[model samples]
Target: MTDLPDDLTRFLAGVAPFENHPDAIAPAARAIEIRYLREGQAARPDSGTTFPEDPWSLYIVRSGAVALCDSDGRVLERRGEGELFGHPIRFGQQAAPYTVQAVEDCLLWQLSAVAVRALAERVPELEAFLSSDPGARLRRVEALRTRRERLADLGLRSPVSIGPDAPVAEAAARMAEHQVSCLPVVVDDRIVGILTDRDLRGRVVAVRLDPDSPVEAVMTTEPVCVDQELKIEAALVEMIRRGIHHMPVLADGRLAGVVSAGDLMRTQSPHPLRLVRDLARASDADAVARIARSGPALLAGLVEAGTDVTQLGRMAGLITDATTRRLIELAEAELGPAPVRYAWLAFGSQARLEQGLISDQDNGLLLDDALDADGEAWFLELAERVCNGLDAAGYVFCPGGVMAKGRWRMTRHRWRETFSGWMAEPDPKSVMHCSIFFDLRAVHGDVELAESLRRDVLEQARSSEIFRRFLAAGSVTHRPPIGVFRQFVQETGGDASKGLNLKKRGVIPIVDLARVHALEGALPEVHSEERLRAAAKAEVITERDADDLVHALRFIADIRLRHQVERLRAGEKPDHLVAPDALSGLHRRYLRSAFGIVREAQQALAQRYVL
Candidate 1:
């Protein structure tokens, strides 16, 4: 074997197939041959004079870029610096299936097929990486790139501890010495409770309690704790949901350390907590709108950083939730306190915490049953203020008038009656309403009102087999857009002509399917992924089917999110329509696979419901 150039060897060692196998780098580099092509020049056919008997060689783009095009000259994929192509020829193909043409003047590294195969034989992973389906390879790459950061990755501080019987003064002194705000109360290597600065101020100073009192008196017993392996994003969600500033981190039932809101805010690049704080402090609708405008940019950054699609949606929903709560507070300040208890409800994507870059508002109000003519009027005014404020903050009113401002602002009894009527009637309009309303979640105020209503709704849905069937039938109505020949059925005669409506055709069907299963199982979860998981746990759906639907939903949603981000960057309004050409060849293939999964689920739904 010939010794390779130092720069070439370094570049080869840095990329995949060789990056993890250092020994293979030298042999792989020894087989290298360099070739350059001018702008628009096409690589010679594999069956040409060069290596005519084998007619196969692997080509890597060292600089510039090239396009892999099919027979019709449609680009199948694009490769740039350090990206490799021509792997197909090694797998028993007599010649390359696609034409490789330089989009610009390019330098290429060429390796003969015999040498490449020899390298693959020596490194099993290299063969797997080279021979696997493009879609599968893409998924593996994406999974590694977007894996959520675990709590252990944060480099958390060693927990400062105080025994439950320790005096409050000692706990405070220990906190001061460590420069920490909280302490975990441990007994026999077990965390029994947690104490924060707030607990000290409120319990000791405010109440004039003796500083010599035991720490257990001021500490919160059996406080919420998270595993050290928990995702940072999930931990943040839990803290925000529970309205906590500090939480103890546990590893295998032993107190490992503590994580605070400040820690999460600093680590999370999206700064969701900081954004929520800003929204909470906004004085008026304009200030809220200014903060809301920054969401797209933050989302774009997350997308660029390869944040998981699920996390992206949750972050977006958190911002919306904060904005809505702040708007409600501002509304109350202007309209005076509410005359009766009320629970503001969110429906559709916001309710499911799956909101994308371009989501319209879908919300309603559930008021206390004791409301009279006067109270109703006051609640209506409050709804109008908040709904208009949300519109100004970029949530935008639902075209269907589902906002709390109008008919949707109903007393608790009326809301229950409405849910009952929908299940009882099961008309087309009722079914459509069920699709949206069934995903209801309480955004603010009296949560019990919403929970009670949800319980009744679930009971009614589960008891009424006819209603479940109606839901199943409705779910299969919007099938995925794969045609008879397995080609994409592009939209026609619109601004997005020839593009795919990823939301309607891809995402909604899966959502509807998950909803049907959720209703069948009476699952309390509103998020689609959670609903699917719960349905599987309840044996309403097979785990395999649930897993498929989950993956399908994630992939479709990811594509939709990235598509919208592209539009935002290009100064265009975001929408669900995505041009197939815009996707890389691997993504396009995976999209088809995802759509196929949806189609299969829809078929099963149709057959199960006898639709």
Candidate 2:
């Protein structure tokens, strides 16, 4: 053992395990301690080691394959030579939480916890790569997360296909059964043509071809085929450029599967509007309610799938709003007789379209104020009924008591007067109202209603310096939670105390800033992220800044969605509290980078506006 020098011992202590890539103290690995495990030897369970509470370690698989099993027999993770394990332990967890068994003669570098922390502190890139899951890293490399290329990567996989000689009826039945828009016609492992729903409707039915006619007769022969090796971005461009919904995949002149337009659409978080569209077409309120219950599922799915936070919020809002709109439609149909011209003003997320899975109803009504006192009183009654109906339909009532049911939010003239008063003085509350009301997209009735209010508010806000101050101040409320002492600020209390709430901290900061930019730059868009990008193009914000914010927002949203999905899978309510342990190594690294971007953007925004 080479004298076991003091510096060397200290370094080994730092790099004890996978979680401890960076040594905790200032020292370098003079030499790593190597141990070879012969076949049939169980590598020490990471849980077995304890010292100084450094809690960081990395088991370097230097020369053999090792399989990790949970207390249960299920495989948790696997590593071969050059791979490492034990990252889950660094987050203060003691248990290796997984058991390891040598599958072959193995050599390992026993990295100490202290050494790993030190290395992580100094080498950010190494920290990110070493901390991330190998599978996720590989996917990122192959799919390209920063842009639109991932679509093609999915589309060119093995396609659902049938033999060309098969009856058109059979192919059509398969398409309907699978809910796919098209089926590729294959002959001897080569895709010769594609039979789409459109083709069946137009060529088969319109032409009165027999249902049992050969699919080849109705198929779009020699359909555009994308090479499996082609970049996803290029495939997307080609698919869009060609105006084709279904593209056949070919690998080495052999048929791979088919990719549909739906396949081309990069898998996105559960979009509220998509859900609303589904709800609108539904047969009854029970179905609408059932779909509405899926809000948490949608939120979690987006987070799990890695959808950007800002986009996820927007999509979330769209679904919530859509549900509200449908519920309102159903309620109104039952109630009958408008009795007056009015705007069903949706406040909060319905107004902003950036709702979370768990949010309450914040709505108001704006009437023309032309009704008599008795009529007006009756209108308030109607408003309460509508709000209550929406609540029964699944939207909980706002705890803060912001709803059309509240008489303060029911008057039409009061709404206009309220904005006017706010414009006249522009105090903190007034500014807050502006921020919330500014997002109102007007879910139902009188399209011109919300627009009139918006135009007046914009005109007032564009000129009022006080309003800008209030807006800027409100926008700066949520700071990115990245710690100054370290890359990320792990929560330190409660169940979610250690895990970052990406929504409130990371996503909201950028969203609010983007909203401020939109208002100040007089951008027409209401969604904060969208407004930011538009403002950038209009020179209100630099394009680079906008891109960074968008990218960071998207990445964080993806994290939030994934976390939510994991919770859903566990049969827990989808929430912002994601266990740091649940994250793949790559995600944690991306989160760190995402936090950095958010911090930089926030600093810049502060310098430009609040500071």
Candidate 3:
């Protein structure tokens, strides 16, 4: 093994892409060249060398600054220490598309494309770092996120499956024999449906259907499935989204394995789910509140266990839902059954399944159209008890009175009118609430009413161009707090030394852009990551930009989540403000990159709408 120049090896060891792959360093360092440049000096690729499959030079800026430029000398991207510039060109007529020049006195290492390829082959992390694929780049960035073992990383068992033509009694007997909660129903060697314990109980046994009937009668048709390569967090998202317990995993168009809620639960510590189950079993509002109070400690524990901030928010959201549901049950017990069907609507973060350490309640009530005044009053009573219970439980009451207990959130008809009105002629104030309200989802009760309301909002929002413009303007209301020099911009007088509120500035900009793009594309997704995906699918945003935005969103959120966890551990009240100077140079780099992406999106948003 050849030795790397001491300084160069140390820098590579510190950089993200190469940090995890220490074994590859010797081979990489051996076939590399090193150079130092004074300020304003330039480094360009060999024009005489063959284009692309040729060994293009790998340039890693070791110190100071470097700027990539065109052949005509137009500056492209600026790079600092530990930043590498070498495009992975598949088929191209070029000797490196970029002209790498040093903008500041610099130290850099140059490696042959052959050596880089060897390094990539040796290091899985290096491969994603060096790949030009958007998905690969996102994965590289997401690599910084929680390091939980994904379901794909697990050794999944290929469970016994039966054809839809299998008799119900045979399926039941298989269940008894195997003790699995669900089994995939296959047709023509592809999964067509799934049969679960719930399906058998609800569709066959409870209905008193003939046990000898074909399994197709009891199987859930066209079941939602996940790819075998999907993240465990993503599989969790699918289950939560579709309300399914078991997911069939497909590989090469064949059923590879099945994952249940229990299987996915193995990815995390059992504590959060245990807390939720305990919450559900709470006997009264006080019990529910008591369980909710454990949330901060639970959040801290999950963070300590290295859960991704995105998943942490979702876990917190599940806890919130459990607390609310238990409180609602207790409320119902006290107020008696309502006269008509109603939905308990959660707006803002909870609705998006993106709750955090501290959140104010943003919810509404949707009543049956047939509900009389007495029915409305009974619903209000229930809402009041639940809302007050939540406030007592650590979720602060919305100062704007967005809770269902308020008159503004009283009935389904009125809520429909409110949504339709906002989508039609969104006033500034309504536009302010649009991001929060448009994300409304049913927490409990008759979800049909909530779904209909969502459909109405989407339909109106799609056609209402003026509403979209106002909404876009509202989206950019909070700008990322990066100054002209790509430094943190802080409130000069109050909390100046502590630095910017990362949530309001860095995180919210990404959220706002996702919201506007989602609305413009008529996407029904509420979560920021999902909305970006939906927008990309609709071509409302480029796939590259979508990946960038999602990466940025998660990066900023990771910072916020970690900060909140630290605050909770310190027994101090947590807030959005964070000190940039306290962060590592790499994190500072991430902050700059994330804020830059957000600014680009903001520019795109402005170009799309009148601001």
Candidate 4:
């Protein structure tokens, strides 16, 4: 190897993987062979006749462009300056059928694979560089979030066990000694029941039960529990739904630890595991309002921590659910209990749990059909207070009066009728209502009402072919803003003229596709990703297409999340409009890719629903 020229050495240090290794420039220049590849210079190797002597070589583009074509002559990938290309180096499984050819005159470093590998071993920095695949590296930056840190990551209280045959007094003593709220009652080294302090206070002392009685007599058999591998946010949702203070944590199908509200508070409070708990205890609108204001800051923290957009959406939805539920509780406390059971329902984004940083609250109420005139009057008053409280808490009421404060949205029986009418008619407004109301979920109260409505909606859509067509029409209403030239089609005229509304033109198309497919297949999910997965599971959509749609949805959603995070950091209100000019070359490229996927998805939907 000869000593490197200064210009050649400088070029090597300028690219990524290499950008971090300035010291590698001299050694790289000395050991690597620089080939000035003129336009279409690299041999095409048609029929494998033009293959280089040692085809196992790494190529780093210093300038100009290169395109790798498959054996069929399809341009499989395009690489530019600072990008690396070489199948033999990336995937070392014999010969690859792709031809590496320069698209223009280029200065490429044809590094010997053997030497690069040896250099990588000696230099730790180069190892990271060499290990990074360019395509995967971008996708990794796009990696919004992985699964929530599992519960095992949140160090738990040591497992304390007591026999089911032990006296209630001894169980209580054990809890006292450990300062724990609950204890798993094991029999034959397996948990059969659990006794909590609440059980002792309510079932034993309150009833004046014999303290010497077997713990099994008072213990809750088969108590609600969670696995140690579950995410904290998911655990919070389950615990909140069950109205339990503590849940037994399991490992290897046996009791491993007890995770109390106190533990979640310590670990996830600032992130909403504890925020939900506080929302539950919020005694008044003022208390709820205070916590709601913190939502934006909390969201900012999540985005900064590189939380995945999907996880961020779920957290936001949980916060909204907890906030709304708290407001309902305050309303109930003030207005007195309802004459009949009623469920508070969320619609649209809230229902789908795709709520972003800013959203107008869209919700309704599902009252028990048994409500009389007085009951109706009581319910209306409650709705007024709750909706108003929510508005004050930053969930401004829907400008379309879509909030729970409406009479039309107040009854479960009428809701079914409303769906039937919409399906039967399928007018513009009715179709619009169908879009909003179809993804309904119970945010609070009698969930069975929601279940019944879900069943009815599926049945109604299944029986009505015309209704499914209308749903398809609604889905294709908005096209992704990517144009025929593989360029962004910006909003020509409107308040959003600065850029495309990433929400409407990008995210919503996939959401609408998911909604249509889910309804068509009678999938029982409200979330877009869940609906997509469920639809795929039923074979309604091929697995590859389904996966493409899912990836597109996440990537588009991540772009919006990033935009919102940027606005929040700049102390400005977050919105979905994003100017392509503001994005980097890589970002714009991915944006086009994401929007392209949505276009393909819409075409798929259109082909399926031929009206």
lDDT of 4 by residue, 124-169 (tens): 5443233323333334434423545777998886899899889999
**TM-score of candidate 3 versus the correct structure, residues matched by position:** 0.77
Candidate 3 structure quality by residue, lDDT tens digits, 439-530: 88898999888898788788788889999998888888788887653456875665555777887887778888888888887788988899
lDDT of 2 at 398: 76
Candidate 4 error regions (>4 Å):
1-148, 188-190, 240-243, 306-308, 371-374, 579-593
Model 1 per-residue lDDT tens digits across residues 1-611:
48678998888876655666678888888888889999888887554322123445678788999877766777655667766777652211123367778899999988888887788787655543554243343455456556668888999988889999999999999999999999999999988899999999999999999999999999999889999999887887777667688989999989889999999888757677777778889989889989987887887877777778887788788788988999889888888888989999999999999988878889999999899999988988888888888888888889988888978989889998998998888888999988999999999999998999999899899999998998888889897887753468888786768699999999999999999999998989999999999999999999877887887888899999999999999999999999977775446656766787788778877878888
TM value for model 4: 0.80
Off by over 4 Å in 3: 1-139, 144-148, 164-169, 197-222, 241-244, 271-275, 304-306, 419-427, 492-497
Q: Which ranges in model 2 have alpha carbons more than 4 Å from their true place?
A: 1-278, 281-287, 298-315, 374-378, 407-412, 490-498
Q: Native-vs-model 4 lDDT?
A: 0.76
- Whichever of 1 and 3 has more TM-score, that candidate is 1
Q: What lDDT does model 3 reach?
A: 0.77
Order by lDDT, highest first:
1, 3, 4, 2
Q: Per-residue lDDT for 373 in model 3?
A: 80
Give residue 300's error in model 1 in angstroms. 2.0
